[model samples]
Target chain A: MNLKFKHKEVRVFAPASVANVSCGFDVMGFAMGTPGDEIVVRRSDKNTVTIKSITGDEGVLPHDARKNTASVAVQKFLEHVGFESGVEIEVHKQMPLGSGLGSSAASSAGAVLAINRLLGEPFSRKELLPFAAEGERVACGTAHYDNVGPSLLGGFVFIRSTEPLDIFGLPFPESLHGVVVHPHIEIKTEDTRKILRNDIQLGQAVKQWGNVGGLVAGLINKDIDLISRSMEDVVIEPIRSVLIPGYDSVKESALAEGAIGAGIAGSGPSIFALTPGEESARRVCRAMKSRLDDIGLPSDEYISQINTKGAQVIDVKD
Target chain B: MNLKFKHKEVRVFAPASVANVSCGFDVMGFAMGTPGDEIVVRRSDKNTVTIKSITGDEGVLPHDARKNTASVAVQKFLEHVGFESGVEIEVHKQMPLGSGLGSSAASSAGAVLAINRLLGEPFSRKELLPFAAEGERVACGTAHYDNVGPSLLGGFVFIRSTEPLDIFGLPFPESLHGVVVHPHIEIKTEDTRKILRNDIQLGQAVKQWGNVGGLVAGLINKDIDLISRSMEDVVIEPIRSVLIPGYDSVKESALAEGAIGAGIAGSGPSIFALTPGEESARRVCRAMKSRLDDIGLPSDEYISQINTKGAQVIDVKD
Candidate 1:
């Protein structure tokens, strides 16, 4: 059988994403611009996937094709498309692993995008989301789309349901900027999930959903003040903040520096603050870093507007 | 102190609202065009508020100024504006009381608007919400704003927080129409409130909030399909539907007749269906009525476009 390939090699860039998003926990996220993963895929003669190389993961990420998120995601895509030829994958980690920045999602998203392009784009970016989520299942226990959805679909994404996989992108203001500060500490997603209560008060749930509606309205209308007011987490933050040192102080610093709102990103030790503009985002990032500095902890800060384009093909070679 | 009156008498029409719009629960509602209360306020020589008469309530509503929602709301408004003159209020109840169509809210909202205009428009309609809420407090045990907010605000209103009185209007499609079916039996708001579980599973809460977010997004974007998908209530509907006979069948009938979505209108007995336009709304209303008819139950049906102009001055006398 003749292999139909648009490009012999393809390189793709997939963005990091911030999930949970305060009151929108387990449902909302947005892609970021700076910290991302780059993956390269080249056609192989043998019908077997291979993880040829991995970079910048501090020697921790798996090298086996079945174990690595990038390779696993690629394999899923290949199987879905019934591709007979195998692909050699190279994983480049641009963001901190387990930093609440969707590190695994970026790798998985990038890998799928790269392989799809090499195979002449069999699937649209959105169709690749499930394959990317499979990577998240391999990395974690749940196949949650909060991280991978945004990382693949771009902009602000809302996951309405996970079972039937209903997700959509939300409109945000052009002036909106995001600041994410990741403290050099790891809080496993599983541990954070364990800390949350199995049940919540009906009143609290009402308040949380109220904020969720308000937040979505605020984003749609581009009402900065309303957005700031609605960015509150009544359920999860209080329970999970205990895992992050100086969480309160860091959030206060971001707000004090004119951030629209601030909250724990994903599962934390990463804190995210939204600002009206890039300058304010930078100021908020500095303030958040200073708070962590006061506690004698190092942190990595990223500033970006919402990534409107998710995964992009950077290079293609015949 | 002299009472400065712009007009000797003022009559206002305040809309009946559907609260707890499916997934929105306690935070969302919208005004209806028909079956609203018409309140007439005439300047009285005496300095104390009085209820002159109430029509269509079958003598069930109170005549005492302190107990009557209309008079109490006007009293609150008069006190807030420091008006010395008393006003005689006439409550014209156009909608069924205790039908979960926010009948009390209509009375309170209409009274406040009428009295405000009689007192030379001392407060904006938005400013009249608290006074109307006080009326709800008088009727029900707790002061909730979901009903009064939209009845005064004239649109789809979202209450972010009740304590600080944070509320905002959400944009929806111009073609949106509402169908409300009030089954003859009354399910008291307090009884419906009692039946709800104090604690709900966290997963259900997440799903509810996700739907809330999706609903808001759908409204803003005018995505009819998303609106239908998001009009699901996983928490309150399951518990409260038992109180209303043939609840599922009635909702199914509405949906089957091309309604976008349908659910219990508040702490129902009243079921509301939303559709793309007036024709579909009428069809859905008929379908819902037929379902109730199937069970040998009588029901009152209302068809309305959203009341964009919430309360209006219908008459004035000098």
Candidate 2:
């Protein structure tokens, strides 16, 4: 491939994401502003991808380029663009792993985005979703986009289908704030997924889809009340919440602190609440954290508006 | 309670509705423009409700005020307002019964709307949904608002819940046209519902809600391609289509005729297709009817844009 390199090295930051978003399990998600993964990509003389270093994950993440999410995503991008030269990837994990805040997705998104910048931007950010999702497939068994979609593209993303790759960016209230509290506990996505029932009642499914419709409509119309009312999970949360300690109390505290709605973030060990403004988001975060404190569980809390600019190039070296 | 009547009599027309709308089973529906039911209501000195007459039903409809959907809705509305004087209702069923075109919902919506007009409009159109839904409960043994919601409010409606009565008006493309073809057959709602499996696979539910979110976003953004792509029913249609003869062929014909999407209207012997404009709608209507015609099955077809004005007073007498 005759692709010219725009930069010798590039750095990118991909935001963390809250997937499922209560009623919209496996379909809807939004990017957060902080606690995201960073990827550093450098043009290499070798013809193969390699992961040079990792940080913030306590040496838990894989270093092999083929096995690691970041390198896998970079490798996939290079293959797609038919780049003869390879790239070296460095992953800086700024968030908790297995916390349900889309850790793997962030790494993948950051890697691809960073490399895309280095390669003179062969594809738009939207076009890079599949490569990021491929990394998700390596990390988890399924190549779901609910995480990578929002992480890469920013804002609220509604993934219609993964096979045909039908994804949509939904409009949300400008004042909308999200409070995410990740308790210092590990709950693997694969494990939480295993605990879910294979079959759910038709009535429950009906209620779920109704809320899904309501949530989408609420987000589009920026109806906070409607969004609050629709942010309920009758199917997955009921089963998954059991895995998180003090989940019920933490969620109640968020709501009591004037949050519009609260639910298990991704596969749990983290609880997220959405409020109308930053003040309410802060209040919700404090309340949720206090509940965890009372239960003697340490946690990390984040407050963010919707990250409208998803993965971006932070710095580049020629 | 004393209430001055603005009119001695009032007549209302409530349009028929298509419920489910593919991926949004039991939660979404839209109002049609024609082939609706007409309700004439007259104030009476008697303290009890009465069904004065019924037409176009071939005597299949009930005359008993307590049993009939129209009278039952009127009775509920009267009791709510503490009205001592009763009202006599006359139902003119312009649409076919047992055809999955929201037959009972139209009668109920028209009755409540007509009576409310005669009583000086005590309830706003939005406030009259429960009364119409009560009539639905009496008719179907369950108070589902998907049909009555659109039939009463007009436009596309996303029903979040029937219990707390959370219904939101959704914005849709004005150029959108619907083609409904009612195959002259009876498939009872109760019977078709019985055939549905109580439990659905979790994966299927995920895909269904994904599409639900997609459809709502599509409607809000007025993206025709997204709307068409999202109009899929993975759970309900596969089971219900068995009862409708030549359902596959009919749907294929509609799609081949340039319909954006097509699905069983409500519980179905009626199938509805949505097209981008009047031209494609007419083509789809002919195509669907031809499929039914090929099987020697007689059908009635109606082409309509969305009925933005749902139930409205057509006439008044002092």
Candidate 3:
């Protein structure tokens, strides 16, 4: 019997998400556009997986399907739900690596979402979250859902739990607009985690929790003033801000330009300003660019609204 | 100078409040009725500070003006606003001391509120919060606003900051019902604070903030089910519950009997149950009492609603 060669391919794009959102620390995240990655997967009748090619990585990313985030996620998905076949994965990385803008998560989320559709959509969107998070663990050493949850599910998300025993996803209000800026630099997530203190003063802990609560309420109620007031960090941001250039000036300038608030995005190199409208977001972008110029650093800005649509199959070809 | 009392003496009773409200830990609180202290202050030109009597204390309380909560609160109020004349303060200690019902805060809040009225209401209600907190420090060794904020201002309160700069007095929904039970034993607030770990895990911290945010929403929306579900703890209650007799049993029984949620009140010795209606509150009281009985402990239960009217001038007798 001769094996028939038929090619069925699908490609999906997942947007970059700004995790932490300043005071939210771990619970809140928002999706962004313009800077995202495209993942393409082709189904084959072989029991083995292969990485056909990779672009825009500049020789840094692995070509092995099992090693790359996009591949690892597909592998995990196939293993969990019992897949009798394998596929070839290709990643077209548009977002910068280690930019703190969910670059790796975009690929992973895109891959899982695209491949799941090719597999006839066996699982729900939430069921794909842990798999994509597992992909993030390949690069960051720990599975942090802050980035993956938003990238996979889209819009603003509150991760109630991640311990495998019990996980909760709360509703995020629709009125929030996330303004993200990616400074052309790299700050690894590991370094960001290392900068944080193992122990904090009791007084600082109370303030941290207070801001977290305030930020959550601000998001839920869509209160711009409360969100601005709540976008403060007395713990991690204070410590992590030292690594990023023009951190204080950019954030202050953004706020002065009518942006509700701005803070170090994720672990650094990327900064996000939250504003109420496109006009304020544009002013915030100009202010941010000026601050970066003053500090001898340049940045790319995106005045994008919060992306409510997370991951989906953009195209399928037979 | 001849001492003459021109104005009528007013006695105000403010109910105790449960601070930390499970997962809130220090940011959220709500007022409760029954088993609360009463403060009576008289306008006098004698400039005399006095504590008339003390009761419901098992030798744990002092009757001296300097040591009593009511006297200390009135004295602090006078010094803060620079009252030209002093006032006489009397305490009717109806609530049990060291029962975690915020007994100290009730006396302090009631005294400050009554004295403020006696002085022609010179300062606003919010201005009396710090003065009352000072009195609580005299009894608890540390100045905490959780109990004092709610007791003085009433309803649900979120203590955003606690220092020379404090933020509180947010609007709370009027639909909350707070059911409490005080077992006839003593659990010192100082001991409770001492037993808590100074540092908490980051995972637990996230959950704590999520619940706190949920609680604020619960209060704002007047959603009883949300309030009940948000009543959870990852830091304080687990450690404190072991000290209270039948704490787990009572909590389980209360929830089993239609109560939304139950947890250690303030710092234990008193446990509170939150329910939607009078019927559920009564059921919770019975459940809590039966748990106390099973554990061979004598308990006093109070089925009460959230006290929207905090500390007020009940009567003015010349």
Candidate 4:
């Protein structure tokens, strides 16, 4: 509660997220362990915010505080909470851009969580979700919490809405492991957005909604077989899969190798498959990576369990 | 159940049903307490099916066994189980036609259940769902189980689909009461179907699906407050409300009278509100009836609890 003797420099890390999650486009996402972003928030004498540096962005990232997601989140938080001390932020993008792995969400979520911790934890984590979602808006032209919510809150997060920001920490099977494959191609979120149809058929919508209900019920009941069956989304996957390289092949390979379900993560170039345990995760990862390589889109695979603790304090310096 | 010593005459009563339940269109429904249909199944010496008499339909109902829902359902049941010998069916319609209160579903459900009882209970109640649904298809041109599922299985029935008949008997608060108001008018389901849009916008679909998931979760958790909030059906109610007389005024009055939520029951011409107990049910019924009266549409009100027992034998003679 006291901030006078707080650490001068604090760094926090937020995990990469897989959004859409098949049946729930823009409404559901889950956190992965390995690929993540870190943000460093340092105290200064001046009563203003600044972005000192951004690494791993290849010089394309902005320096201004208002324009960038991490700094904008910091700016928004400071302005709302009336924390007037100067804060300098350094964004370290460990995740790849345009990988559909929620890279932008990680940076913004890490920044706000770190800055909040450094400034004595003035706001609750739930209160800070909107700022992270707002940061995602700057990167993707939409304020969606599917990625940012899970990245910040950890585990599997279901975002019912962004307005007033309703989020639920869904109960997923503890043994669930995610096999994620990120290919070396850059498919902009905007370009992926262009592929999706503006309007959906009624039959498809009903079928998809039924699957959504079944999926939630599956998670709540801890029925892995039900989860695998309910994850068969009829609406978005049929259309959006065309944009991803070796999409069908990857899904087929993953399922054949004991993965419960596989689909395009977020907007795609990246793909993810959910398996029951670590063994299936490894098998699915290998299968998916092989499919991508056979299709001339050699990719990197990461075997991860669901990140239960989202963003956490990595280091603090005096 | 032994068929050789079958009952000479049997009469079965099936409770009326409320389909859709706002958020889940064509996928969910529940049975109400009163104003249900009665069907008489009699064993005859002749080797042909016949409809002896029809009541309460004012001769609008077909006399041919093949054309009627009750006889069609009976025929389907007999054909599936290879039951021989002649059977006579007498139709009785307790509820008004096109009341948006599952009148057709009640007829089919009552018929199948009664015949199943007469033939010695060869099929379980779950297996009888398809025959009832098939009978519903003859009545409404769609084999949806929203009405028939609840009318046969009772309680809060959710039909994920009718193909393999994926149904969940959702655990709802036992004290929940339904207040129904049916105006002296008829809106054909076919006519109501013409008013609905064929395609839905992506944003609306996501919000609707999220609410559906929330609804299932709320029912599972027995969180009444959450159910009340999650029952908002933005996708269906907006488009279908136009078919009902004084729809907005009636819904406004119901919610104003402390009803948790109110919407068009299945299609139009009838409105129902869910309340916590009998007292609130009475209050909501009065509020909704007054609204219909103010709009010059005198309506009848029914305050009933959930019909946990779907269809039952009123009288059976050996």
Which candidate ranks first by lDDT, i.e. highest? 2
Residue-level lDDT tens digits of model 4 in B20-115: 787887777889988899999999888667888999998898889888888888888888777778799998988878888898899899998888
Task: List model 1 lDDT by residue over B79-153, tens digit each.
Answer: 877888788999999889999889999999889888878877766788889999999999998889999988988
Q: For residues A1-318, what per-residue lDDT tens digits would candidate 2 score against the true structure?
A: 568778999999999999999998989899999889889999888888999899998988999888999998888888888887888888999988988899999999999899888988888888999999999999998888989999999999989888798887888999988789999987788899889899999999999998998999988888889999999999999999998889999999988989989999888788999999999998889999999999999999999998998988899999
Runs with alpha carbons beyond 4 Å of true place in candidate 2: none
lDDT minimum window of 10 residues, candidate 4 chain B: B1-10
Alpha-carbon local distance difference test for all models: 0.90, 0.91, 0.78, 0.84
**Candidate 2 TM-score to native:** 0.99
lDDT of 1 by residue, A54-121 (tens): 99998999999999999999898878777778889999898999999999999998998898888777
Every candidate's CA RMSD: 1.5, 1.1, 4.3, 2.4
lDDT of 4 by residue, A1-318 (tens): 234427799999899999988898888899998789889999988888899889989887889887899888888877777677888989988888888889889998998898888877877888889888788788888878988888899998877666656688788899999888998987788877787788998778888777777777778778887688778778778877787778898899999999988888988889899999999899889888988889788787788999998888899987
By TM-score, is 2 or 3 better? 2
Model 3: how far residue A27 lies from native, Å: 2.4
Comparing 1 with 2 on TM-score, the higher-scoring candidate is 2
**Per-prediction DockQ:** 0.90, 0.93, 0.44, 0.63
Which of the two, 2 or 4, has more TM-score? 2
Error of 2 at A265 (Å): 1.2
lDDT of 2 by residue, B93-191 (tens): 999998888999999999999888888777788799999999998889888888999999999998888778898788999999989999998888899
TM-score for each predicted model, relative to the true structure: 0.98, 0.99, 0.87, 0.94
| iRMS per model in Å | 0.6, 0.6, 2.1, 1.1
lDDT accuracy of residue B122 in candidate 4? 82
